[model samples]
Target: MRLTRFTDNALRCLMVLGLEPTECITVHAIAVRMNMSYEHLVKIVQRLAELGYVETVRGRHGGVRLARPAEEIRIGQLLRHTEENLTLVECFDPETNTCPIAPACALAGVLDEALTAFLDVLDRRTLADALEPRQQLVALLSRSLDPPTPSSTELAS
Candidate 1:
């Protein structure tokens, strides 16, 4: 199953934070580095803060850090939080799904199993696990921010 944009960005944010455990990363800084909209990141950060996934510190020096250790932040937990619904079919949704034969639908059961299996695999991993090769991840993220070396004409300006 495909993840939504919210989940994708949340995972990216967590990965970036995982790389710099010793530093508190400002939401603005993360948004800039990730090439994401600052306003969107602000909302995402606020949600994360409310969920106890990340801690927000207020003030000029304020920023965010993982509320718990990277090791403790499980991948499945994030997936669960980020996903609004795991239903693959209309019948999977109990409220709106009024399929006439939902009680006998093997398709729905199979889909449910698939979703659970997917989460089960992710559940075995943590944010720390996802952050392997973190130095490389940091370098990949920081590349866009690197200042280009000026040529003579450019330097004059």
Candidate 2:
């Protein structure tokens, strides 16, 4: 039931972007804010952009921003996109399954139902729902971190 680090980072990146919807924040800044590796965040951002979750701008003043409103970004949809493998059990993937009792395993069906129910709950929620406590999140994020710095070009502009 646990999500991968890639999905985790993607969610965190979206939350940071949601915090400043009108502005483009650099990947480096996001990495700093989220305490994530810059390199790892870059890959996440690239995938997110490819999935149309975020838009990227290039150049010295370039940064990233949400492609759509937080309310339109469903958590379940995002999870489905970010998660490379959703297979909870070996039997979930027929091609690679090595389970000897997969054909008769009732556990697979039960696990599948549980997984569906989990995603169903997330389907009902959106990024906006997660960010409902905006002020609280902002306060906590700012408590120990300095404000993200603008690029040199952005400063000149």
Candidate 3:
């Protein structure tokens, strides 16, 4: 079961916010740091805010921050909210399923069990768990904030 880019970006956005829990980081800054489209990140942030996962501030210093502590943000719950469709197979969605053997397909049951197990693992984890390597993540993300240096070949020209 693959997650959509929307969910992926949402996770990335949350991880960034989790890095600076007390500070309100702008969506643009997150986009730049995460190499995401600003407009796309905006949509993700808006959705997260509406879901009570993020708090948005306004004005000159306005930006976004986590609404709750990272430890409280369960990965499974977030994924369920962010993922539009959790259906792992065509049979999972009866409305659009055109499989002739869907009615008696054991594969569907197996896949369903697999999907449940996948989410179950995520359910046991939280944003804080993902951020356990805080110092390492900070170092990597901070590198993106630095201005790019000219290549050796460019310097020779």
Candidate 4:
């Protein structure tokens, strides 16, 4: 099953914060580095702040940092918060199920098992897991802090 872009971006935000546990990174910078929309990242950051994943400070120097340690931030839990829906098929959502064979569909059960396995694997991992080889991640994300330059394709356009 494919994850929504929102979930993917949320994970990226968490990774950025995880990379610099002590520093408050701006949503704008993350948007620039990840090539995402600032407005969308702001909303995601707000939701993450509300969920107690990231802490925000408001002002000229205001930005965000991880509210909890990276090791404590479970990937599955974060996905649950960021993903609006995890239903892989119509039969998965009780309120919206309209399939004729939902009542007896073996495929639905198999899909359910697959979903569980998927989340279970994620559950075993944490934000820290995503930021492997600490030094390398730090360097990579540090480079991301630089102002983005136009790509060759964009320059051509």
Model number with the top lDDT: 3
State the lDDT of candidate 3 residue by residue for 28-77, as single tens digits: 99999999999999999999999999999999999999999999999999
Evaluated with TM-score, which candidate comes out highest?
3
- Candidate 1, which segments miss by more than 4 Å at Cα? 148-157
lDDT (CA) per prediction = 0.86, 0.93, 0.95, 0.89
User: What ranges in model 2 sit over 4 Å off?
Assistant: 147-157
User: Candidate 2's residue-wise lDDT over 1-157, tens digit each?
Assistant: 8999999999999999998898999999899888999999999999999999999999887899999999999999999998988999889999999999988889999999999999999999999999979999988777648766899999999
Clashes of each: 0, 0, 0, 0
Q: Candidate 3 — worst ten consecutive residues by lDDT sum?
A: 85-94
Residue-level error in angstroms, candidate 1, position 154: 9.4
Residue pair clashes in candidate 1:
none
**Candidate 3, which segments miss by more than 4 Å at Cα?**
none
TM-score between model 4 and native = 0.87
